[model samples]
Target: MGDGIVVGLGPVEVEAYIDFACPFCRQFELMAGPTLDRLLEDQLITFVRHPMDFLDAVSTTGYSTRAAAAAAAASDAGMFHEYARTLFANQPPEGGPGLTDGQLVQLGQEIGITGEQFPETVRRGTYLPWPPFVTQRAIGRGIGGTPSVFVDGVAIPARPGPILTAVQAAIDGAV
Candidate 1:
């Protein structure tokens, strides 16, 4: 894979740094999903979604880390984008209990990742330590917030229009 969960075959590389419990990231997902999906389908850019865990402490059960770990599990099962989009659509409020492991497994199952390993991996939080490394990687690159977007190594606004515009600009050699 290119970096995180690589999702397209395009010349430009786009990195989406997100936290499961971050409402802004959820909003970004809601707004940008269609546009990003179009871009990915058109092979305009390679989308690598880097799920992080900065908001784990906000939830009663460390939902951020759990969710990120589950996302890693989904990625391994070839369901990262679908499962993550579903999670975003059903996202629980920040500072709340968030989704339980069972709920996460249910969501994964809804997306067709129903293998026993998926649920077991989610419950075990096997990928718990991965988010910290992803966070540190983002931090090393000066990205400290959720919904941070990068196009070909350049930081771009997280909004849908700006993200698409930046992708186009990168493609046109304008940015």
Candidate 2:
């Protein structure tokens, strides 16, 4: 979450880049998000979200690109954050049920987005496309794997505590 969305807190900035279908992304949400949320509420930093869904190849839920497209469509319908929360809460694991378009829409419905056009939007590729300029740019910057996250344009190391520490440290440095 970058330029399209920016939530402010304090002097630091915490931006999250993730794919809905990536297990690691889900894990990050369950883990780092809370910390980021706290940082956000304290106005200690700004939170940005760059949602990506191209990890379709490892999907057991279907294809992430489709899910991502669906999420984007949901976003277009002004249900982006809600859809994101739903998607992560019901993640099927990496290389598992990643999220079929229909399911994505169904989840949306479960979460208050009642329009039936949601799934159809994905099927029709109505939202942002994969290989999206932003996604490609992120990948080009070295995001070959799922949960490939960067804080303030710097790639973060993978271990959880260390990564969290690094992110907070980055934010601290910014302040």
Candidate 3:
């Protein structure tokens, strides 16, 4: 049960454990997305995003699980990156009801992930178990929080600056 949504085929492997409902994870994404994109473009690192649901209980509607499942649907449609960014950009506050299934579908549509499969997947909760599974696996691996980052199998601070620095060091070391 490999749960990572992998992007890129670079030499160094960078894994990010995140929860959709986590504000800090959102911040990390906003801060590091571009740099990660550039690194992917340059084939410096293989980015793997492990979408977890540890924060599902924080939201009134289990937003973390729902959103992560929706992201899996987006990944099926080959639009995971866009859908994730949109979700983060429109993140609802904790303790509130997260976006409805309809809104998730709409977001996917807005990102050009059309067709019935995506919406149907969300509505049917097809990947509902995925987030929790990944969350548990992360916990089993000693990852205790969201936005945990690893560069070349070495844990690094989830902050943008440290992530960038660690990724750069990994790239350099590979040379």
Candidate 4:
């Protein structure tokens, strides 16, 4: 219900908990995108992305929440995947001032998410409150870190092989 993206239509669901400021999450996202995209195209699974903001302190400018909120805005605009990938590709180093609200809006535009509403949403932190709730939910589920992925409620490694294998297993078992 918060700032997450849900795609795909296969028999199983993959829930990915991630933090924008985490490099490991970025790496996993990049590695997993193509495989997931293929599955989505085939309607073989449902991918749910849960964005977290545990690394807010790492960025001098509070980029974690900002980015998460921007993502929610993108989701509303139907551009979650593109916006998220762009953010990961342009991820700023931790401990530095992350991208500004303006930059986030610009990125959205670059990815075809337009209108004043998107930028205004990013600027206003509309979805800022969502990440903590998401983090709490993850913690309640015994997940302590980013890049946590689940297939049919079973924890799977962030690596491509394990994730794909688990998803395939879920698909095969369903059929």
- The number of the candidate with the highest lDDT is 3
> What TM-score do all the candidates reach, one by one?
0.94, 0.72, 0.95, 0.95
TM-score between candidate 2 and the true structure:
0.72
Per-residue lDDT over 70-127 for candidate 1, one digit per residue giving the tens place of the 0 to 100 score: 9989988988999889989999988998998999999999889966999989888788
> Which lDDT tens digits does candidate 2 get at residues 42-115?
77666566766567556654466666677777776777766776788997766776656667778888888766
Question: What tens-digit string does per-residue lDDT give for candidate 3 at 1-175?
Answer: 3878988899888999998889999999998989888888998889899999888777878899999999999999888888898999988887788999999999899889988999999999999999989988899899999899998888988776876788777767742
User: What is residue 58's positional error in candidate 4, in angstroms?
Assistant: 1.6
Angstrom error at residue 33, model 3:
1.1
**Candidate 2: worst-modelled 10 consecutive residues by lDDT:** 1-10
List candidate 1 stretches off by more than 4 Å. Answer: 1-3
Residue 51 of model 1 has an lDDT of: 86
Q: In candidate 2, which residue ranges exceed 4 Å CA deviation? A: 1-11, 60-62, 115-120, 128-132, 158-175
RMSD to true structure for each model, in Å: 1.4, 3.6, 1.5, 1.5
Which 10-residue window in model 3 sums to the lowest lDDT? 166-175
Provide the lDDT at 56 for model 1: 79
Q: RMSD of model 2, in Å?
A: 3.6
